[model samples]
Target: MGSGDLNLLKSWNPKLVKNREKVWIKEQELLKENEILKQKQLEITKERELDSLVDPHHKHKNSKKNGLEWMYSDPTHNEDYLLGKKSLDSSVISKNNLKNDSKVDSKIDSEQTKKFDYSNDDPMSKFKIAKKRHIIQTKEKISKPTSPL
Candidate 1:
């Protein structure tokens, strides 16, 4: 209660004023608690709405076209990606780092292109088959001890 409220209470009997203050305080507390419960209900409803939208097992005839369905199958969102989470931080970075990354990416791409052979003699031959090495197991000679009767 503000000073104005207290000043208003002064016109009433002292005992009645005290009782009114207590009642006001209790009402204020209840109001705050009611607001908190309302906020919680809103949050629970939002979570349920999001769960309904983002179902992992949901698929369509034409490869799950658009929105939450497409986002569900995305490789980056495979685990622990919550849709309702806060936006990304606005941390500034040096332009030099980004430039270096682009240069490195271009170099890697060029190297990969050079390494890739387009010739396909056989469909199966295009895939490199790894030779299986034979592992020999050597048996250790165990000498039998003479049994004493």
Candidate 2:
């Protein structure tokens, strides 16, 4: 259609333009709300991290009813229970735990070169075996395998 015809059509359909404007306004509002929620989440996470640093077992203390319940219950928790776990660590472990232990350890090492501090309540720090294996592998790799006769 001609530019003039298009202009005429637009002039005719003021309601359509208003609807689009309304939709755009709603979308902008939603985006702002989402940003606000994200900021709140970040603040909450930072607070939790601070609390954890001060009291290493803050989560455990609050969640568990008693010492026996905490001990007897399965130490392992599902991904849902472990907040911020997935977000922090991007490395994926192989399905065969026994066979891929070394590989996963290496991956973890390459991903995180710095030694894990026990005081830092890192979600990935739960895998003590992986860190131990990585440390052993790192030492082994450094020393020359050939022995002089």
Candidate 3:
């Protein structure tokens, strides 16, 4: 190649290299920003989960503080128990209440009598009490049963 052509090639090579570096740097910056955004979203999700666990009254406060409008807007997350809707909160409360009441009743029964027959003939009553009794029996079995191994 000629001297002028060689010079031109050398100049163009550095420019091309600089342009490629700039593009790579911009791409890396974009990737970093995307990763940061994803991390922020994950942190927000974790915070919401932790908040839900720690504060059971968060949903109740949302309705009471923000009014029915906000609750209606986000029924899946907020005011889910308003009449016709079947809310997760309601199910959780019912299950917890059933557990607590059964525990209290069993404690009372144990104080009165040594042996308690938990069997009931009524299907609905049996279904309602079965889980609580199963839990109690499992706990007793764990505490009293001798290991074979």
Candidate 4:
């Protein structure tokens, strides 16, 4: 080959080499990222497996209820029941106080009445309106003028 061809080859060769090196570096990075992702996926799967194994709900069907009770119940289980009763009593006292507070009671009554009114409204009426509007919009779109000539 002539010097011109040699020069051209030399110029092109470094670029090709650089391109190949870039591709190789990118592949390595991708491989590293893929490995990290795979490890994360493995960790997630291991966590799920461990969670399933440790979960009281996943115990043998016959033992599940007892396992759940044991897992969730306080260390001194009776204490929890007593505390629950105390909380119930406290709530009752608070409810009585609210009833005695005329302003609070009125507000609560108004809120409850509004909720009752909303509940009394037929839920299906909203669905029917939505369906009717959808049909009307669809028909309008379908019947829209195509073009002006």
Candidate 5:
């Protein structure tokens, strides 16, 4: 009825203002929860990457599609056949259990393919260039015989 009471009533909404502080606190709590979930997701992704490097076969096993689709696809599923992976047999340092982390050796045989690319390894690129130069020189000599020299 007084001017002071009228001022308070005009500025206040019983439905919204009464729960405004509670809503703000809830929002802060949810933000913290979301951040924790994001951190967990990052950790999971890192772990999965490490697992993939250890064993490329196990890499896709934990995928979202593994749940129902995999179960129905092959009833007599051998894990190794399911993901066609052989043991590393060389390079990869297996820190995880060998049973869990299969080795990955991607050796490119010279006869098995076109150009034997030295994996673009910088250290070996110099040797590859030298070998190529030698081959070119030999061909040049053969094409234009250099008088028994």
Candidate 6:
């Protein structure tokens, strides 16, 4: 072989060059996939932020929690309930329907209260009780008259 051909043969490493190409291809594919995922995440966050701007209360309204959470969290709903008015019942509703809705709400409330069975094994039960107790103690300390030292 000529000197030029021998130099080319000596410099060529096919296995290493092929491995490098494979690694580069894999890196490019991973980078492209990562960029696509970032774009989708940004789009989802933008949509959620826009919805929040349009209706700040949509989260509470659209949440999939059990019916219990709305009572303490929704001030408007609580006020409506205190006023003996169902959310769907307008001011122009007949007195009979109003009474019927109130009765239904009362029955549901009673049943829920009666069926609230917090077990000792419940992981959050102790925490909830402790939180309430701490709140009560703080309120009591705040309300109590301090002795003149």
Q: Report the C-alpha lDDT of model 1 over 1-149, residue by residue, as the tens digit.
A: 55554644565654676777988999999999999999999998997677558854333322433466554332442123246554443232344456557777886788588667666456565443322111121122234455699
Q: What residue pairs clash in candidate 1, if any at all? A: none
Relative to the true structure, candidate 6 reaches a TM of 0.34
lDDT by residue (11-89, candidate 3, tens digit) is: 4464467767988899999999999999999998998799689878776653343346543331242334555576566
lDDT of 2 by residue, 1-149 (tens): 55554543664464577767888899999999999999999998997788689878657644533447655432343354266555322233233344356566776776475455655466576577678889999998888586789
Question: For residues 1-149, what per-residue lDDT tens digits would candidate 5 score against the true structure?
Answer: 55554444653553556567777889999999999999999999998788679768655444553457544332332445347775542333243344232322122232245455656668688789889999999998899956775
Could you tell me which residue pairs clash in candidate 3?
Answer: none
Count of residue pairs whose backbone atoms collide, per candidate: 0, 0, 0, 0, 2, 0
Name the best candidate (by lDDT): 6
Inter-residue clash pairs, candidate 6: none
Which portions of model 1 show Cα errors greater than 4 Å? 1-15, 56-149
List ranges where model 4 is wrong by over 4 Å. 1-15, 56-122, 125-149
Ranking by lDDT: 6, 3, 4, 2, 5, 1
Question: Between 1 and 3, whose TM-score is larger?
Answer: 3
- Which runs in model 6 stand beyond 4 Å of their true positions? 1-15, 62-149
**What would the per-residue lDDT of candidate 4 be over residues 1-149, giving only the tens digit for each residue?**
55564644664464467767988899999999999999999998997688678874654434333346654432432344477654446766676566557655675677577556464257798788889999999999999987888
Ranking the candidates on TM-score from highest down gives 4, 6, 3, 2, 5, 1
Clashes of 4: 0
Winner on TM-score (3 vs 5):
3
The better candidate by TM-score, 4 or 5, is: 4
Q: What count of clashes does model 1 give? A: 0
Flag the better candidate by lDDT, 1 or 2.
2
**Which segments of candidate 2 are over 4 A away from where they belong?**
1-15, 63-149
RMSD of 4: 19.1
Per-residue accuracy of model 6 over 3-116 as CA lDDT, tens digit each: 554433543554467666988899999999999999999998998899789878778654654668656442343455568675545553466466668877887797588657
Candidate 2 residue-pair clash tally: 0
Can you tell me which runs of candidate 3 are displaced by over 4 Å? 1-15, 63-149
